[model samples]
Target chain A: MKNFMALISGILFSLGLGLSGMMDPKKVLGFLDVTRTWDPSLAFVMGGALVITVVTFRFILKRKAPVCEQNFALPTAKDITSRLVIGSALFGIGWGLAGLCPGPAIANIFTGNVQMILFVAIMVVSMIITEKLVD
Target chain B: MTISSEFTPLLSLSGGIVIGLATTLFLLFLGKIAGISGIVRGLLTGKKQDRSWRSFFIGGMVLGGLLISFLKPELTAKVYEFDTFKLIAAALFVGVGTTLGSGCTSGHGICGLSRFSKRSIVATITFMAFGMLTVFVMGA
Candidate 1:
């Protein structure tokens, strides 16, 4: 049951990425391009998502715990440390340059976008490299 | 609402609804948060017991695209440009950053903060702040 739900959820998420124009790198780049050819559509996507999430989460939290999970696996740390700052900086830089985040990048695969594949390849390779270095 | 553009509000609304439904269903049926970060992390770390969730989660993401493609072939085929070197660098950096932060935007920003997690709050703020700054520096 858990696996089935996970599969369905991923499909839904990818569909959202497709419909929201997030799967298109040009649309994402347009959002980044504030001065020229600036597209505010991505903002709508974000706003729409925020609206749904805010309302839905409110109802969800009313429950003592989640229906399927034993408990919510919440984060426990709360420090504005150097690691946090540096990591965010890196993520922002990547998003700005590639116009693709992990979620969208993966979704782009269905489009058979060559650039997305390249991006995903690098993303996976980078993940491997970083893991080795950190260990 | 009279639709003016190919990208209609209804498309977004329905898309969001699908996303919300998927997330809720995953939580209720899978006993898991629909967080890409956790799934990917577990897969990479060789958490054998956790592989099922990760595989199913990723499979769902891919399948979602396929389904959408069937409905809107034209929209799915839109072209976009890419710079290989920059993208590679960016992915590497994000990989490193996510590792250090112990979560990505989905995990920390979405799921964690939704639960009023202090760590997620800090991580999400950090993510946004740096994203703003990066855009500023890159002149994007």
Candidate 2:
């Protein structure tokens, strides 16, 4: 039951990304390129998503548990550590270069783009490295 | 709706709404954060129960992408071109950065900030600043 829910959610999320032009590396670059092209479309994307999430998440928070889970698995860490800062900075630099975040990269995988395959393979390798070395 | 000259605002908004709906569904039903990086990581580190749903969700993403391209046809459009050298460098940065940071654009930029987590806010600002700075610095 939960797996079905997860699958459905994944499909809808990817659909949104595809339809909104979020999957386009060029579009993502445009959004990030405030100094240059400055496409405000993704701002609208973020705004629209926020409008829905902000309202609904509050309602969900009031509930005892989710439909498929006994408890909510939420983030627990609160401190703003150096790991967070440095890691995010590097990630952002990568994002700037390729405009392909993890979600969009996976969502666009079906396109059989060699760049994406290389990007994801490396990304996974990096994730594995972080797991072994990073505390 | 002020549409950007190069992009369509209506479509972007609708797309975002759908993204939001999917995330809300995750929260309401699965009690999970629809964070791609975290989900991927969980498949590696989480208890046995955690891996299956994550795999299913990722499968859905791949399947959904294929479905869109197959059905809409127009949405597939042109596949983006890549420069091999730059692409490799970018992917490495992504691997290290996302892993060290504990999240990515979706996990931090969307879910984290929405949850009003202080750490997420800081991480979000850091990444956005660096992303813009990187582009400005590289002039790419």
Q: What lDDT does each candidate get?
A: 0.65, 0.82
- Give the lowest summed-lDDT range of ten residues in model 2 chain B: B69-78
Residues B1-140, candidate 1: write the lDDT tens digits.
Answer: 11122334566555555565666666555545566655676677756877887887887787776676677654553355455677677777777777666666566655665566676777777765665455545544
lDDT of 2 by residue, A22-119 (tens): 78777777777787768878887877788898889889989999999999988888888999999999989988887778888887776767677778
Candidate 2 per-residue lDDT, tens place, B19-120, comes to 889899999999877888888777776679788999999988887777776665345323677677777888888888988898987788778878888888
Q: What is the lDDT of residue B50 in candidate 1?
A: 70
Question: Stretches of candidate 2 above 4 Å error?
Answer: B1-5, B71-78
In candidate 1, what are the lDDT values of residues A34-123, reduced to their tens digit?
555556666555455556666667677666676657775544566767876676667766767666667777766656567667776777
Question: Which 10 residues in a row give candidate 2 chain A its minimum summed lDDT?
Answer: A108-117
Question: Which candidate ranks first by TM-score, i.e. highest?
Answer: 2
> What residue pairs are clashing in model 1?
A10-B60, A10-B61, A11-B60, A11-B64
lDDT of 1 at A40: 62
Could you tell me every candidate's TM-score relative to the true structure? Answer: 0.82, 0.94
